[model samples]
Target: ASARKKKGDSASSTTPPTPTPPTTVVAAPRLSAAAKGDKTDESDKGSDDDNDDNNDETVKAGSESDKDDDD
Candidate 1:
């Protein structure tokens, strides 16, 4: 019974520290982004613009292919 109680106490102690790590992990990335002069935001916007351009090009290509097929 004493051994079982010790095991239970250890498990509960371990569980509390598990929650702390995630808060630190969440904070770490924001710190890295700030350290890099917040380029993460600019990179994300640039990626979005690239995606838009690719989508437009795909639409144009598809239309051209369709016209070729019709001819």
Candidate 2:
């Protein structure tokens, strides 16, 4: 009962946070423009961006410590 009270208090007292949706839209305007015409690589660019970001973060961490930070 005491544990539950503590858990409830912790949960309720937490401020509402803005959650970033998992959907990754890479440049909506450019994507729509590409769909109209001009062969534009969307997946490649998005993947590359993700890879770059991951690499940059990994480099900053200086090792495999990123996995731990996520937890």
Candidate 3:
């Protein structure tokens, strides 16, 4: 009976660690999702900066045309 109890205790101990691995597996995907979100945000900022540069160039071109008309 003592040997049987020891075997049961060992099984119980091993079962808890089996659940721990799944928890780590679940957390890994969450971290990867967060990293992807950050990359998307950076790309959006880069696109916005490009739009601002285009707007500035348009304004400069408009001003130059206005100067030619004035002359």
Candidate 4:
């Protein structure tokens, strides 16, 4: 047996799912003091540079494997 619909029940009461905004990558502005030839503390600067090493291929190996399986 089917259940009866309640009074004032409208399927349009719920809001529709919104489309995700187009994703974009934003870059940091060039370091002004570095660009201007004003030197900051060298050790701190070197540490920051090391943090940016692009190891995505090594770190994201699982994702690459998934893509390979999808082929």
Candidate with maximal lDDT: 3
On a 0 to 1 TM-score scale, where does candidate 1 land against the true structure? 0.43
What ranking emerges by lDDT with the best candidate at the front? 3, 1, 2, 4
Ranking by TM-score: 1, 3, 2, 4
lDDT of 2: 0.67
* Decoy 3 TM-score against native: 0.42
- What is the lDDT of every predicted structure here? 0.91, 0.67, 0.94, 0.50
Question: Model 4 TM-score?
Answer: 0.23
Candidate 2 lDDT, tens digit per residue, 1-71? 99999998777665333122222244566677878564346666778888999989979786557667776
Q: RMSD to the native, candidate 4?
A: 17.2
Candidate 1 clashing pairs? none
What digit string (tens of lDDT, one per residue) describes model 4 on residues 1-71?
Answer: 12234322333233222222221111123455464454546657866666655455455887888899999
Q: lDDT per residue, candidate 1, 1-71, as tens digits?
A: 99999999999999999998998899998898786776766888889999999999999999999999999
Better of 2 and 3 by lDDT: 3
TM-score of each: 0.43, 0.29, 0.42, 0.23
Better of 2 and 4 by lDDT: 2
lDDT for residue 44 in candidate 3, whole number 0-100: 92
Off by over 4 Å in 1: 1-40
Return the lDDT, model 3, position 39.
82
Better of 1 and 4 by TM-score: 1
Which pairs clash inside model 3? none
